[model samples]
Target: MIIEVFRANGALLAAGDDLARPAGLTSARWQVLGVIDGEPRTVAEAARTMGLRRQSVQQTADSLVADGLAAYRDNPRHRRAKLLAATPAGLRALADVERRHAAWADALAARLSPADIAAATAALQHLATALDQEPSA
Candidate 1:
């Protein structure tokens, strides 16, 4: 089960990366922009959302900023930590990626019946919950 899940996730990530290349972003960079699209967040907050280390997210955000894809703003909650937000170009890129993602998801869903899709989604959610309860290494 674990291996199957990992394989699926790896394939999904590879597809996302391939789709993002034309936009001048990688899958990792796209994830950061997508997270900040809903609201501004500190590097730590984004890292936590992505299940990544703060330092890694910080470096990703720094690169995005340098590439003019994202920008940092003053965070009221933390004096030292800055909030990350996507720039106009980033938003445009995100929109394009989101559209492609939706189309891809729809194509996949069309292959399964509604009931089958719902069952698969529920099972995946349960598996994710179970995994989340495990102790971190």
Candidate 2:
């Protein structure tokens, strides 16, 4: 199951890259953008939400800032940990990526049974919940 999940994650990342490329974003960038779209969050918060290391998210956030897609704003709560917010350009890019992804997902879902898809989704959600309950090493 874990191996299958690993393979699925790899495939999803590749697909996400393809889907986001038109907007000049990689899977990592898209993931970060998705987290801070409507409501901006700190880098550490984004990293924890994505189950990724803070350094990785920080590098990705830096690249997004360099590309003028995102910006680091003053955080009223934390002085050092600024919030990562999406600019107009970044929001537009994210919308494009989302549109493309929706089309791709719709097409893929069309070829499969709806019941099967629902069951799979439920199973994955259950697995994620169980994993989240586990204590960190």
Q: Which ten residues in a row have the lowest lDDT in candidate 2?
A: 128-137
- TM-score for each of the candidates: 0.90, 0.92
Q: Write the per-residue lDDT of candidate 1 for residues 1-137, one digit (tens) a residue.
A: 88898998899899999878878888999999998996989999999999899999999999999999899999988898889999999899899888887888889889989998889899999988988898877
> Candidate 1 — which pairs collide?
none
User: What RMSD does model 2 have?
Assistant: 1.4
lDDT of each: 0.90, 0.96
Give the winner by lDDT: 2
Each model's total of backbone clashes: 0, 0
- Tens-place lDDT per residue, model 2, 13-132, is 999999999999999999999999999999999999999999999999999999999999999999999999999999999999999999999999999998999998999999999998
